[model samples]
Target: MRSITSRRNVIMKAIVVFIITGLLTIPGYTLAGTSNISSNGTPHHPAFVESRDDLVNVQVAHRSSPSHPMAPNTADVNIIELLQQLNEPLILGYLENLTSFGPRETGTPSCDQAAHYIFDTFQNMGLVVRYHNYTDATVSGSNVEATLYGNDTTNIFIICGHYDSVAAGPGADDDGSGVAAVLAAAEIMRNYDFDHTVRFVAFSGEEQGLIGSYHYVQDAYNSNESIVAVLNADMIGFTATGSDGIVGKIFENPASEWIVSFTQDISVIYSDYIGIQLFPQGETWGSDHYYFWEYGYDAVFYHEYHFNDYYHSANDTIDRMNITYSTRFSRLILATLAQMAQQPVQQRPVLEISSISGGLGVTAQINNIGDANASDVKATILITGGLFNLINVQSTSEQTVLNAQGSMQSKAMVFRLGKILITVAADASNADQVTKQATGFLLGPFVLEVVIAP
Candidate 1:
């Protein structure tokens, strides 16, 4: 009986060792079939993380680009012309409107007067204006909203600034700057007929924690309003002036990269001649834009990087303001709005396989459904798991074919066709890019098979 028991124990030990060996070999077996295989033919752990700081959770929606190919009407909206228009009368007029009382805090009589001034300005421009008013005790204020309808009323872009000045400070740079920019943009685009709608808002109670913006966003959401992006122009009046004073600042948000890119493109085109410096700040807390961003709305904060010292004190008056900076900033905002208003919709890519018989050469086509063209678009193939290693695919305006190296960033390759995967990956952008991956494999080899055999 003792001998039999010893033999059983040895067999059990062998079984456990075999189980451990199989478990250890499982990942290798699985990756061998997929594109996760290394150049040495060994399976590699696919680098797929749940979250990445730079990764954008982009939705392939049929939306239009904010860039319209149309030309601008006014050729001479230069610094001289812009500054001439934003003269002392206009600057002081706006400041007076802002500082009619000490601390035009929300819900105060001063707040109401500020709203009236903004509303009157919009009305005087001969454009339709609407106000979305709500009472909030936090800032103890009321909100003002104005909308200029376009050819397409279904889609709208929003521009907002806080009008209610702070209590201890005049809040000129804090928001009076933003309010002025909003008015300037409104006046410029008043007579223009756009393809998309625009809403110019002067928010109150921002010092009290974005109360007005919260109310506005809540109302829009409740009404099922379709707003694509919210461009918050706050505190752009004062900038670092000198020889290199042309700096364009935008606060960064992971969910709003597209908006930031769009603004950057416009700033590059419109302000580069002035030596424009485009800055993307990742951390900015105070402003009305935060409320819209909180609601998952694509929001971008436009400002000048180094604001002047006269921000929020008794000295935060209009005389110290930089009308040149304000004019340039306003013009940029107007240009962006005008361009986006007439943009064609963007299309998602559609992949179609044409011929796969050329051994390593796979040819296909990519169709763009959106009106906007993906000029630099490329393609890459990843083997689910097989002997065929996906190198790189290049896209042309007409076709996308697999290349030996698989460089996805090849500008020569336009992705009018579907991507072809072969021995190499087409570009570095897709080299580490993952389409799908498993977290952990505990059981056996994960095999991804690429069947080239007909």
Candidate 2:
């Protein structure tokens, strides 16, 4: 008994609903307000629009983002001296040998030859060497892993670089520098013992969209491995004209920022030995680190700040590369890995507030009484119990490191006029915290009298 007009309205509403539902289900169809737009005002298609596999890969890449530990403020003497063993000539020799295999394109005989050379070198270093074989629809190759197993086998750290080149060139600068660095690191680090296992890996098929790395990471994930951190080096030997040979760039994603910060600390602590400075940059997807990020592991990519014009071409050879730069970069990475993999039975640092005084400000002397070095030490000064209990101020000192039996002074300027209870405390990573207290009369940037609390 419905009216003709009402019937017509109902049909029209159903039509509209059906049209919208159909549009929502279509691939590449985005709502008007929700469409992703590029910086140039063009409508950017979502990854799924081109291929559903791309969307799946992106989702997998964001599966897990782990945080890394804070960096230390000081370097170990043993590590510093060990770094002296890495020289320009040593790295150049490795690079020359790698490139001698010719262009190591994946699935080619040259690539197989290069893999064999790396495996043999690792075996010669007396490390636990193995070939991680992987086969996909496009490429099949073996990833070489040389492991220095730590006392704690559950925790693992990896330093890696690709060894494959494009079809056109030997790929010396593109990755030979990185491979050379890894081999040099393995040669030196094999003699030391660490708390966590360290892996030196050379992957192939990197030029073909990270095939080897992707396969390796996927398997590691499937086996439920606990990988602490990954440091990846690619194309780290080029120094352009007018560019400072000492400065290198480290690229990292948000999850791997701690690793970048840690590398920065290593650069500062070993600046004299490495002779290389580091600057942190945002994430890049062109290296093996991309696969680690995709599987939720924290990783950082080390590369030259100056791009190589000869990348992926026949011109990427030894003469065009800087061996000194490569050696320095390799030294920095080696120092970082050595620290992250703590030495077995190493003594922990002990921090103590040796003395507290007030003059132009409140000053506290912090000392490392333990046999080990104290890093990222911080001293804090607190003032309270002034006139009418109106004073409650606090100040902290800049973070620093104290070698065994070494001491540093931390001061906080005060501008109050009254009697105050002063509490001074100092702490550091891997060290015991210490505190001291005293009653002082402050007179405009100076303490007239202080009574030490027993």
Candidate 3:
């Protein structure tokens, strides 16, 4: 393993002299490869084997890679490392403190202690924190909020989890995992600078039908807060099932497809899970994210995607959690926040021509209205009734370049997402045409027609 100092040096070099063009021109690639294509007939480059299947394809019923060589360049995020170090222990300690308070049921004494603990932690992080207080029947609780102002309030990114634990279960996997993830993310994010404001929130009364979250959402609406996305981490700590009856699952709310997709993209490089699982059923109304989604804000929930058999049981203790998994999961959240905090709000492509056909080769163009550029242009040409579906990519085409100037075009294909829709995005750093160039550019959507006869 390389020393931290060595890693820092490489990272500095990559930052100082990283040529975007050269990085895109590696030879015999397996990861994300960039290329320049020529329409004029020429010898074709060999396609490298895919390292993973496209998750978007699995979710949206479509999906779509490459390599280039350059002088050895490396980078390590010291901030990420430092943040991880600072937040990991803080999270463990927070969990310990919560355990001390006992099971935090809605309107219970333990719940109040947990709430105050979260609020104080936010204040300690040097954030401008507040509470969205409300009541349900006899119970009154608040959604703790911590804000770090950025360039604009209209561009807001929220990271949240529920702090309240269940009564009979102790609620370790149910939410203690999520609360830990949120606290850790907050501690790390507090030290960073972003172009958009970031909100770190912990809601109480989630297990009791999202009362706390509902109150917070109403508060946001009343205050006219411009929330772009809500990243709800609920039950992220439970990573394993022991022989004594433990169920561990990871959940990413389906409503948060965009957020999930972006997170998964980064996870491909930084985390253990390569198969980015999207579309895991509808919102269960189990966590805080549902409140945000219900109120018209884009929201996604994150958790292990299985059942914790010890759920709602006293055995749902912290010892059963995969600490190593939790630690890595925290890092994944860190990387995602770092990347997203720097990005403009995400925007899906406006489908111009849903389907196009010509038995002969046809072209498609999709527009991206978001400030960020779209890359990893995957055009899946499927033969509806035939036994063939052609996959074409402009990100690796030597002749096709989809820059901020215009939509990327494929070398007119005969069989496309036949009578079907296609999706495009920045799948890799090499294919990110909008990196710095897309900082302020609002490119158009991908408009393409498919071939029905051919």
Candidate 4:
């Protein structure tokens, strides 16, 4: 393994050169092979690119511009609620647990255990979970994914962090902070609905020259997934005492400039809530978000402006981190995601079944929460399964028109003996259908022990 001190010295020298020259150039690449040299023959940042073979066989993928353009908008009141839901204790707990696993180097038992822990946590959140396995000559590991499917499944938004740490330390601030942020976002955002799918990913083998992210991006490109944007958090926990204030540095490439602008807008609109300022920086390929750029996908890297001296060392632990600062960064990311996946701005009916109750019969409340009035609003209730399959009742609401924010109660539908499953649906001419299901036991019009499905 290369010496960490040497890498740090190289980075410091690069920074000095950049400062002295005041001339920043993009990293040069060849269509035939992988190289980090620029047109002037100067190598790019050595801290990020470990070896030339990391980029082998990686053809530059082409993609058209995004269909859903990002626009500057004020923070939504509902998104504020999501921001408030980011719990500091939960974030701390995740970080502490991750650091307890010791050095999680790729292909080691500790790294495998960390992967399973992340996978299990995502599974417990009731998300669609899976393991993306990859193998190369030097290392092999899996990337854990937890997906919250949206109304439009094709469009995707990703928030990711590397789970494997260096062999020297637990990597609490280096990346454990980032993994905690992703977990916290997933835990809270799963309860709400969005127009675009959100994926929480924890990658392994990142220390081995971005191996995990490279394979994952390759597969995503081959499958033709329409990835909208990616938010990658690497180190966001430390803030030195007597510093000016918490400042986040967001790094982006030319293709992802719009994402940085959108993030800046979000930071401003939510400044009162997050209390953290942002600085947009030029391209840097030191983190996992770099491969997305190679595949023609837009991505940004979120990093701390104040550098931590304990990075990649044995002293990088929870005691050195600031939980409040980390939680605030998570809030900023959650707010950005909420706005990016927001519903269309057009005025249309959004029908929902607010509630369903049973006493002498089953009744459901249909609500129109959209801005426009809904015409031809209809509701349906169907009950199936009971003793001898003899108790089945189906009913529909009377034809009606509902104004914006208007709600109507469905007529009671009575059913007889045995355990049953009830499915209620509501729809409008301008809105898509919404359905709710429940399981209950009915003893002659007295529905008992009803449980609703999520």
In the range 68-117, model 4's lDDT, one tens digit per residue, is 44565776888888888897899999998898899999899999999999
lDDT of 3 by residue, 322-389 (tens): 65555656566666665666664433332122233232343334433333344554432221111122
Over all chains combined, what TM-score does candidate 3 have? 0.57
What does candidate 1's lDDT look like per residue over 1-454, in tens digits?
5698899999999997786555433331111122342211111011121222322232321222232233333333432243335443564466566765556666777778777878888889887776667775444556666678888887788888888765666767667877877777677567567778888888876666666787787666656676777888877777555643577678756556666776667666656333355677763545667656555466778877675576545676666667666666766666666666766534322222222222222332233333332333343332222222221222232223323222222112111112223321211111111121111111122212223322
Worst 10 residues of 2 by lDDT: 39-48
TM-score of each: 0.60, 0.65, 0.57, 0.65
Residue ranges of candidate 1 with Cα displaced over 4 Å: 1-88, 134-137, 221-224, 254-277, 343-454
The segments of candidate 3 whose C-alpha lies over 4 angstroms from its true place after superposition are 1-79, 82-88, 241-255, 272-282, 345-454
Model 1 CA lDDT for position 449: 26
Model 3 / residue 309 / CA error / Å: 1.9
lDDT score, residue 77, model 4? Answer: 85
Better of 1 and 2 by TM-score: 2
Residue 274 alpha-carbon offset, candidate 2, angstroms: 1.5
Model 2: residues with Cα > 4 Å off, grouped in runs: 1-67, 343-454
Please name the candidate that would achieve the greatest lDDT relative to the true structure: 4
What is the model-wide C-alpha lDDT for candidate 3? 0.54
* TM-score for candidate 2, residues paired by index: 0.65
User: Given candidate 3, what's the lDDT at residue 398?
Assistant: 27
For model 4, the stretches where C-alpha displacement exceeds 4 angstroms are 1-54, 343-454
